[model samples]
Target: MAHRKWIVWIRRAILLVLLGALVYHSTIVIQIIRFRTINPRMTALMRQRAREARARGQVPKRLQVWLPYERFSPHLVRAVLAGEDPRFFVHHGFDWDQIREAIQENLEEGEIVRGASTITQQLAKNLFLSTSRNPVRKLHEAVITVELEMLLGKRRILELYLNVIEWGDGIYGAEAAARHYFGRSAAQLTPEQAAFLAAIIPNPRETYNPARHPARVERRRRIIQRRMRHVLIPAPFRAASAKAAESAFAP
Candidate 1:
């Protein structure tokens, strides 16, 4: 009798867990479908940052300006592609090759120093999820990423990412980053400036911050500039980038 009761309890627990997962993912699907037409006014990271600032007794400041896809410079687009996701245009919502490489590197180094997230995955996490690396959050991010790809195309995804990604302590989006870092608009950023900004995307507040580590940022900027020549933005954007950038570096 006790054995049967134990099995019944286990079955009920499994059903409850499955039911909770269904409800969670169903809500995510509804939100993602709405994202097809609705531009997000704010993102999960913004809210998280605000709460953190409040807990620390520091006022939260946000700098963000939403611009349509065409308003940002093509050079910035190229630089971002070079620095963050070189195969963004080809991949769906994930990059298996990158995952394999990152896994191999982690094994060799005996540490987790690299990430394999695609731009689409990053956008999904920033838009709707927290920065935590917990398994539940990662699973939710995966679901959101798939839904985002199913609902929004590559161009729209890129535009939303460019507008929502955190570039600094209070800076969000290309326009705000440009204004804060270089005293210019997103549309007017030069290739080198754009490259510098892009190189800091992985960790804008510390490792690659120009204020704290200009030398590291500069090295990454040069590497990105070289990669920019080969990186291609998704259409309907033109390909006439980086060639003009070559002149900027001519000595």
Candidate 2:
């Protein structure tokens, strides 16, 4: 009798845990749906950074000014696409070719040398998840990525990504980064400047900072400029895309 009762309790506990997980994931889905219209005031990354700052006995500072899609410079858009995801327009939420390439590269290098996270995946992580790359978090990120792609569409995803990407210690968004770094608006950035900005995105706050590593940034900027000339911007950004951005869209 006691063994049967123990088994029943175990099943109930498992059911409760599953129910809780469903509720948690459902809440995230609702938030993602809301994001289709309402821009988030703060993202998961922003909130996490704030918490970290508080833990370190410092005030959390944020600098972000949302710019409409049209307000973003064509050079900036092209540069970002070139630097981050050339196949942004072709892929849904994940770039399988890049994933395979990255896996192969990592295997050859015997280390993680490249990442395959698409713009959609990156945006999903920024908006909803932690900085951790653990398998569980990655699974959740994948789910959220699909939800974002299904709900927000490509143009909206790109807009949100540009508006929320971390550029520096306290900086967020192209508008804020432009103002902080160059004393200009996002729409005013030149091609070279835009490429440089995109080049530093991987670790803009530290490692790849233009202020701290001008030579490295210049090298990356040059590479991105070359790529920008060979990549095509998607339909939503086509009207605003740079002349150099015209290229075959097939991936």
Candidate 3:
């Protein structure tokens, strides 16, 4: 009788959990629909960081400017794709090859030494999730990424990512990063400048200023620049490349 009672309770708990998950996911789907056209003013990650800063008795100010996709330099776009997600244009959301490799490396190292987050996955995490490394959080990120890819086109996804990703302690977006680092607009960034920005993205908080770690940043920047020459920019962004080139020459 006790065994049957325990089994009943377990079934009840599972149903409740499934119901909760369904409700939560429905809300996320609604939000994704809204974001298809509207630019987000702030993201969950940014708000979480702000709350932590306030708890520590420090004020956090985010420096960000929203620029249309055409306003950004082509070199910056290509360099970022080269450094972070070479398969961004090709993959649906996840990179299976990278995922398999990362899984093997993590098993051997007994810890996560590598990540296989595609640009879409990274954007999903930045927009809607916390920085917690847990199975639940990763699942949520994956779900949101699929929703983003389905609701918005590739160009919009890349634009949202560039405008919301952290570039420094307080700097957000390509425009802010360009002005903060190179004293130029995102449209005006040189190939070298763009490559340097892309190199520090993986550790933006620590390597915010490329000048501070010239050797490390330079090495990564060179690698990205070399890759940029051959890496394919998605077709949607190709038209902007000519505009980006013109802006690079602007006085």
Candidate 4:
């Protein structure tokens, strides 16, 4: 009788856990749907940084001004795509080729080093998940990535990503980044200036001031510029309203 009771309790516990997971995932799906049209006020990373600043008794001044996809310069978009994910429009939520390459490299090096996260995965992590680099966090990130891609589509995904990605301490979005870095608007970002911004994305917080690391930033900027030449911005992400602006400022 005791053995049967123990088995019954174990089953009940498993069912409860499964139910919790279902509810949690359902919530995430709902949030993704809502975010399709509504811009998020703050993301997980933004909130985390705010908490850290509060703990240190420093006031966090988040500088983010939402600009529609068409208002941003095409140069900035191309530069970011070139530097971060050259295959952003080609893959689903995950880049299988990059993952395979990363796995092979890690095995050969005997350590996990290379990252194969697509822009979708990064957006999912930034929006809903913490910055923890554990297996569980990665699993959550993957699940969230699927939800985002399914609900938001590529255009919305890229729009949200460009608007939320951090460019410096408390500086968020392309507009804020452009102004802070070059005293210009996102729509006015030149190719070289945009490339510099793209280059600092990997180490945004530490290398916010490109002048501090001119050689490294310049080298990465040149690489992005070269890649941008070959990259074609898809119709979905192309700014319909920026043609006149581009022509007016054409060099």
lDDT of 2 by residue, 15-109 (tens): 99889878878998898888888899999999998998999999998999999887788888888887777788888898999888768865885
Backbone-clash count (model 3):
0
Off by over 4 Å in 4: 1-13, 100-115, 207-212, 241-251
- Candidates' lDDT values, in order? 0.83, 0.83, 0.82, 0.82
* RMSD to the hidden true structure, all candidates: 3.2, 3.6, 4.2, 4.0
Backbone clashes in model 4, listed as residue pairs = none
Off by over 4 Å in 2: 1-14, 102-114, 239-251
My TM-score estimates for the predictions, one after another, are 0.88, 0.86, 0.88, 0.85
The regions of model 1 sitting more than 4 angstroms off are 101-115, 239-251
Q: Which 10 residues in a row give candidate 1 its minimum summed lDDT?
A: 238-247
Tens digits of per-residue lDDT, candidate 3, 184-241, equal 8998878899888888887777643565767766777776777677667756676456
lDDT of 3: 0.82
Relative to the unseen true structure, what is the C-alpha lDDT of residue 221 in candidate 2, on a scale of 0 to 100? 81
Lowest summed lDDT window (length 10), candidate 3: 242-251
